[model samples]
Target chain A: AQTIHQWPVAEIKAVGSPLSLGCTIKGKSSPNLYWYWQATGGTLQQLFYSITVGQVESVVQLNLSASRPKDDQFILSTEKLLLSHSGFYLCAWSTREVFFGKGTRLTVV
Target chain B: GDKVKQSPSALSLQEGTNSALRCNFSIAATTVQWFLQNPRGSLMNLFYLVPGTKENGRLKSAFDSKESYSTLHIRDAQLEDSGTYFCAAEASSGSWQLIFGSGTQLTVMP
Candidate 1:
């Protein structure tokens, strides 16, 4: 069985602060990783996706970037956070099916 | 311009009743996935389909690539089933990225 773990279950940050979120997948190797963001009561938006380590594709530009430093590790980061950046962030891995992590709830003050 | 649109933006169902949610895709979707967002904002992947139907317990889903549509049927609705249902489509363009719908909010009443 595969499991995904996301760090800092919840975050509260200032508008100009930098932010970083991390995800790790165990029991699966060389899986496709993706980042998704969803606003309260809004649709889920694909932010970024990586097929392999060292290669990430941007699906939507929201001043956020992602990197798959390792086959099972994905990182989402921002140099400067904006008020609009507050939302629920989810990390997922896909093989034949997609599995999501618990997700991180971010609030920008 | 929503490429993936889910019908009946909101629905209210009584316990033990049945309901079906639908999604229509304007893009050439090669695969479809259904997810449930719980009240706590946790998303659980329910089904992933490749132009076919799948059933799990009281839930059943079907996808038709030719028609560019998908359907999810829930039987014996329970309170725990109250949540937002989302359908995402993967286009045939080889992007392998999911295009999600606005979601259908379902409320099961006791």
Candidate 2:
């Protein structure tokens, strides 16, 4: 069975600090990967998705970027964190169906 | 303008009862997917619905492209079924950038 993994169940950072979040998929090959953000007590929002290595599409114009450094690895990063970046970040992989990771709760102070 | 909207926003149900959650879309949706977000903050993919109905165990979901809507029916709701349900749609343009509804919070009480 395929499984998705994400790191740092929760995070706290100051504004203007660099940020990085990571995701890895096991038992899947070249599946589409995505990054979704849900604000505190808010709705789910698609942030980015990638179909193949070195390619990603942006859904929302937040100050965030995603990269597919490897086939099974998708990364989300920012040069400097913003207060608005505080939220629940989810990493997912999809072929026929999308499966989400445990997610990382980011609290930017 | 809301491209996708979920109805009721919240619901309460007793165990062994039946209930339905709905999502109405303004965009020309080509595909719909339903998800359940538990209190633990994990989002589980429930169903990836097309323009028809699908059944799995005690749950069923239907998506209507012509009607621009989708419904997830819970049969004999259980206590473990309490959570927020969300519906996301992809336009015929083929962009998998799913636009999600606001979500409906369901509570199944014993």
Candidate 3:
């Protein structure tokens, strides 16, 4: 079975602080990785997606960037956090069917 | 305007009853996925469809790509079924990203 893990289950940061979130997938190789953000009581929005290591595509311009440093690892980070950046961030992998991780809850102060 | 729109925005059902959720897409969606977002903020993928119908336990989902619509039917609703249901569509003309609907908040009473 495949499993997805996200780090720092929750975080509270101040505006202008740098932020980094990580995700790792096990039991699956060369899977498509994606980042999605969902606000409280709102719909999800695709942030970024990577088909392979070293190549990530931006789906929305939220002033955030993602990188696939390794086949099983994906990183989402920003130089500075924004108030609007506070939300639930989910990491997912897919090969036809998509599965999501536990996700990270970010609160910007 | 919303690309993917879900109807009834909210619903309340009694235990052992059945209910259905619907999604309408304005884009040319090639695939549809149904998810249940729990109160704790985790999205559980329920179904992924490609212009067809699929059933898993008490849940059944159908996607009609030609009509750009999808439906999710829940049978014997239970307390644990209380959550927000979301439907996402992958458009044929865009990147392989899912455009999600606003979601339907469901409350299954015991």
Candidate 4:
């Protein structure tokens, strides 16, 4: 069975602080990875997606970037965080079906 | 323009009753997926379809590409079933991006 693990379950940072979130998928190789953001009680927004290592596509520009450094590793990062960047961030992998990770809760102070 | 729209933005159901949620797409979708967001904010995959129907326990879902619509039916609703339901579609344009709906919030009352 495949499993996804996300790091730093929750984080609280200052507006100008830099942020980095990570996700790893085990038991699956060469899967499509995606990053989704959702505000409290808001719709889920697709941020970025990568079909393979070293290639990532931006679905929506939220001032965030993603990289698939490895077949089973995806990273979401930003040079700086904004107040509007506070939300729930989810990492997902897809093959025939999509599987979402537990997600990271970010709060910008 | 709301390419993907879910009807009945919110619903309240009594335990043991049945309810159905629907998603209509304005884009040419080739595949559909259903997910449930629990109260703790965990999203779980319920079904993934390619123009067909699938059933799992008390949940059943159907997708029709021709109609650009999908439906999820829940039987014997339980309190644990209370959560937000979301439907997403992969457009036929060859992009792997899945367009998601606003979601339907379901509250199952005892």
Candidate 5:
């Protein structure tokens, strides 16, 4: 069975601070990775997707970027965080069907 | 315009009753997937359909590409079924990019 793990289940950071969120998929090799963001009480928006290592595609410009440093690892980061950046961050992996992680709840103060 | 529109933004169901959720797509969707987001914000896949019907336990779903719509049927609804149900579709061929609906929040009452 494959499992997806996301780091720092929740975070509270000050605005303008750097942020880095990580996700890793175990038991699956070369799977497609994606990052989705959901604002409070809003529908989800796709931020980025990576089909292979070292190549990432941006879906919507949300002042964030994603990188697939390894085949099973995908990272979401930004140089500075904004007040509007606070929301739920989800990491998903797909082969035939898509699967999402528990997600990280971000609170920017 | 909303590419994917879900009906009945909210619903209240009585236990043991049956209900159906629907999604209409304005985009050219090739596949559809249904998901349930629990109160804790964790999304669980309920169904993946390719212009056909699928049944699992008391839940059944059907997708019609020709009609550009999909429906999810829940039979013998339980309290645990209370959640925000979302239907997503792949807008393009083999894009793998899922466009989600606004969702239907279902509250099952005893």
Candidate 6:
């Protein structure tokens, strides 16, 4: 069985603070990875996606970025956090069926 | 223009009844997929669709490539079926980026 893990399940950071959220996928190799952000009571929005190591594409520019440093690791980061960036962050991977992680709740105050 | 459009943004259905959700695509899609996001915030894979129809238990789905549309039918609705349903599609000629619908919030009433 495959599983995805996300860290810092819930976070509250001050405005303009640096942010980093991590994700790891187990039991899969070279799978397509994706990052999504859902605003409070808003629809799910695609943030970024990576096809392989060291490759990522931005789907929605929200002053955020993603990095695929390894086959099973994905990181979403930003240098300056904005109030609008607060939301639920989800990391997903697809081999044949798309699988999602538990998600991280970010609150910027 | 939105490549993927979902209907009935929200629905309230009585238990033991049946209802259907739809997704219309403006781009040429090669494959379609459905997902369920439960209240607990876990997104579960429902179906990975091909151009035709498929049935699993009380759920069924259909995708038409030429017409660029897909529909999800839920039968024998139960309280556990209440959640937000989403449909996504991958374009045949464009980037592998899968586009998702705004989602349909379904609530089952007793």
Model 5 scores a TM of 0.98
Q: Comparing 1 and 2 by DockQ, which wins?
A: 2
- Model 2 share of native interface contacts: 0.85
lDDT of 1 by residue, A1-109 (tens): 8999999899999999999999999999899999999999999899999999999999989999999999999999999999999999999999757778999999999
All candidates: interface RMSD: 1.0, 1.0, 0.8, 0.7, 0.8, 1.4
Clashing pairs in 6: none
Cα lDDT for residue A107, model 5? 98
Worst 10 residues of 5 chain A by lDDT: A40-49
User: For residues B1-110, what per-residue lDDT tens digits would candidate 5 score against the true structure?
Assistant: 99999988999999999999999999999989999998778999999888999999999999999999999999999999999999999888768589999999999999
Docking class of 2: high
lDDT of each: 0.93, 0.91, 0.94, 0.93, 0.94, 0.91
Per-residue lDDT of A1-109 in model 5, one digit per residue for the tens? 9999999899999999999999999999999999999998778888888989999999999899899999999999999999999999999999868999999999999
lDDT of 3 by residue, B1-110 (tens): 99999987999999999999999999999989999999988889899898999999999999998888999999999999999999999887336688999999999988
**Candidates, ranked, DockQ:** 4, 2, 3, 1, 5, 6
* RMSD (CA, Å), each prediction: 1.0, 1.2, 1.1, 1.0, 0.7, 1.3
Predictions' DockQ, in order: 0.78, 0.82, 0.82, 0.84, 0.77, 0.66
DockQ of 3: 0.82
The residue pairs in collision within model 5 are none
Error of 2 at B34 (Å): 0.9
Q: Rank the candidate models, highest lDDT first.
A: 3, 5, 1, 4, 2, 6
lDDT of 2 by residue, B45-88 (tens): 89997799999988999999999999999999999999999999
Which candidate leads the pack in DockQ? 4
> Could you tell me every candidate's TM-score relative to the true structure?
0.97, 0.96, 0.97, 0.97, 0.98, 0.96
Cα error, residue A28 of model 1, in Å, equals 0.4
Clashing pairs in 4: none
